[model samples]
Target chain A: MPPRIQIISILICVFLVAYVFELVRRRHLSEEYSMGWLVTGTSMLILSVSDRALELVSELVGATLFTSTLFFFGLLFLMVICLHFSIRISALTKQVRTLTQHVGILDHEKRNLEKKMHQAPWQTSDSSLEQI
Target chain B: MVTPEDDRAESVSYPEPLPQAPKTLIIIPAYNEGKNIGAVLDGIQKHFPEIPILVINDGSSDNTETIAQQHNAEVISLPCNSGYGVALQTGFLYAVKNNYSLVVQMDSDGQHDPANIAVLLEEAQKDDCDVVIGSRFIGKAHYKTSFARHAGMLLFGTIASIICRQKVTDPTSGFQVLKSRAIELIASDEYPPDYPDADFIILMNRNGFKIKEVSVTMHASPDKESMHHGHKTVYYVFKMFLSIFVTLLRKSPKR
Candidate 1:
């Protein structure tokens, strides 16, 4: 790679890596949570570097490396966001199931308590108390 | 037909005996606590041997499972480190499927006193509470947590209470006794991840389960280095708050 292209590649990699690190630091991305963003960031940087090597061919196609890189990154981000949403959906489903099960148990317990209350002799009207 | 003893018992209140429901299950979720879980299990076994203990080894690369198994605890090993929420919900699922009447969640870090486990059970059984959280800040005990973490917890608890429309003193307290229903409710597929205590508590309240908090002493963990500090702590706080906000926006399920 030429010195200028190499510098550009290095800068691109640095910017993307730093941005992802910032996401993690800001709690936008969790370190142990998932590998989606890291993969996306690294892959996008590689694509940017390769596209620069093909700059002459790309100029024939009237596309700049910067624009193409941004476009690819946008797609990568969308994919990661979609993955996150799916994970959230699954987690939410588990929460709903657990919540319903708890409700059912509570209902069952309430009914049992009600039955006991009705069956208790103390719950009945006492003629002996009236006599006293 | 009322003898002196029968009259005394009846005078106390209702005469019907509440059949001893299924035994309460104690769930200790531990990660890399090889040094603590064995002792914790022994302490619990010595004190409450009647109650079964189940340890959810949350993908510990250490000897967490071996320690738990050696200590006679029923072990449920997760294949990977799925965070505390997954480990806890797994315990709840186990409780529900096994027909346990109540479930107690205690950390395996040895910070939580095993003797205090009975207080949680008592609150659940006597008050008929759907959930009883062992609050470290509620009573006279000295809270040794960092100021930032303390403020974070208070804020989280207050917000959780408002969202759930119920009083929640220690929404993030891992030490809790949950009625079978409460356990089953949070074992749902949509259970919030990372610091799920608040969201799960709110979920119980939304489902009409009673929630209560009891003050308990909290001792510092012997392994201070085990704490997740710096950027990780920031991430935990950020994710926890975000999860709560997102959870609040979710529409409640129709009865």
Candidate 2:
């Protein structure tokens, strides 16, 4: 019922609502691919608004509730980057597989051509490759 | 203990007609063919009872896997439908691990005649080749294929022949027989998943593997529409040709 508690509660609701809407709007979160960031954000927002925890932590760290909330979000952002890179690594691995296959095919053709040249009546070495 | 005679016998026909014959495995890649998979398997079983069959259920949400299982076919359900290329690759890998001497791939749809599999295997067993493709154009049948599909196939065949530097009649035909050595090489990730018909010919040729086309009968799929859309046909052709160009330009894998 205190004024500070009411203000913190309203702020927590605002942060949680904004976080949920932003995630939905940007299409970052889906049923199948959720990274649990929304849950983390909700928990952080609640903890930041808890008057007892805020008073004790603010007293010890000398930081306001708003700054504490910002810190939690920054941590979430870092986690998102990590998750993104993991997906990218998987995609790159598939690409590397395809590239290796292409390289293999070309190398095989070169060897066949070399063998053909050696069997030819007028054979030329690599130095004279362009003449033929 | 494989003598030259044994090698000679292998190149002659399917099942090899020997007591110590190598096991033959057939892989059918199915996508959304709930109705046709059952009939295809039935016809295959009736024709080649000795061969074990495996169906690569390419992430079909339908009863393809269930029906395949019902027909006593081994099923490897891909987590998602990667494409026809990946489905066949999975089957090739299965063949390699299981030590199958020969692996045959037939469309799960009833369009591909299972009886022709025996014909392909006979040609494949001949010691000179690694890949034997079933060519509808080669056989003396009614050959009722559409002009558009035939044109597409011919174009692919011509491009593949140029890239592989060998004559190829049906590059896009999915039905074929592959030797164990060819299977090991093809089981790798490089095989194209969509429109693999052309890329595979070039891949085999580059690996110093012999590829030959034999005439076989293939009926039109009772189901009219192909899995690929009209736009996808263009995309598939572009990607297939581009990959062939790039593959031709790249170096082969070292032994």
Candidate 3:
């Protein structure tokens, strides 16, 4: 890779790491989810700074071109991020369903209580007296 | 046409009546069926005047709740539009909590004929089964359904019947009668949150619940289209197959 391109990639990686850290500090992104991005950003920074490491990675990955190795890692990172999102979404769907069931049951109970209150005005007074 | 009075008379004289008619509650899960709910409730009231009806208004953006209330049917409005399974499960939970011995669940779209509630209840008692399903495919009732839906039903019916070790003709039928035991099981967390069709039948069977099928007449909604319309038919088939396969992998739930 050209020195200018390497310098630019290093800068972008640094920016990514800094941004993710800032997001974590502000409690916008949780540390649990940001760990993957942090690792990816750090690895990209290391690969951009070290030409020998980049060359070894390209050879190890059997990529004819260094840029192809970079592209492959980028795609792999995106796929990992997507997989993480899918796992989170699955958990969230289960949670939402459970919450909805609770809401439905609670709503039904509330309606029944209100109906009871309407049917017998003295019951409310009895409850108030008991509370006092 | 069978008059409401005739239907009531027939139900009263049905063979093998219980020592006392079980305290039955009809659970109607309504989703944006304001236009049709009134007629459905009226039909139920006309035929089964003694039985109380509870309508779970599943966050419809229409006057479903109001219409049900107007017809003197108890309305339990879910805060948001949950799926069909959630709505039905809510009713089951209510039934279990209120100590209803027999709970009959039917759709509010008028597809499930209220007149057949007697048939389902009788079958539940006669067969000594926990659940009685009203199957459309069994009877001579000319229920007009789309070809794609019928094909999908056939596929699911075969898979469910094999897993359940019994012939399940209409696994997707909403008209069902559940005894207290079955209601307790369904009210638990084991019930599917989405389409609880054939997979639910298999789950019930695995959980030691006896399920029997009774033939009943069902009609399509006048204005509403089938749930398996167009591209949805393909997605429905795929999702149902996957759900059934997953259900097969799950262990038998504890009683």
What does candidate 2's lDDT look like per residue over B155-198, in tens digits?
Answer: 87888877777888877777888898789877775666554667
**RMSD of every prediction:** 15.8, 18.5, 3.2
Residue pairs in collision within model 3: none
Model 2 CA deviation exceeding 4 Å by range: A1-132, B1-16, B225-231
Rank order by TM-score, top first? 3, 2, 1
Q: Candidate 1: which docking quality band?
A: incorrect
- Candidate 1: which stretches are off by over 4 Å? A1-132, B1-19, B225-231
TM-score of chain A of 2: 0.43
**TM-score for candidate 1:** 0.62
Native-contact fraction for each model? 0.00, 0.00, 0.69
Per-residue accuracy of model 3 over B1-255 as CA lDDT, tens digit each: 454534653655345655787889999888889999999999999878888999988899999999999999988888889767788888888888889999989988888777788778767776568999998888565576777678878888998888777999998888899998889988887787776688889889888898998887777777675432424666777777787788778877664
Cα shift from native, residue B199, model 3 (Å)? 2.1
Q: Give stretches of model 3 more than 4 Å off.
A: A121-132, B1-9, B12-17, B227-231
Candidate 2 lDDT, A1-132, residue by residue in tens: 256755766586567657766777789766334445555556555555676755665567666564554465547665875787689787886765444433433443464576687788775566676665
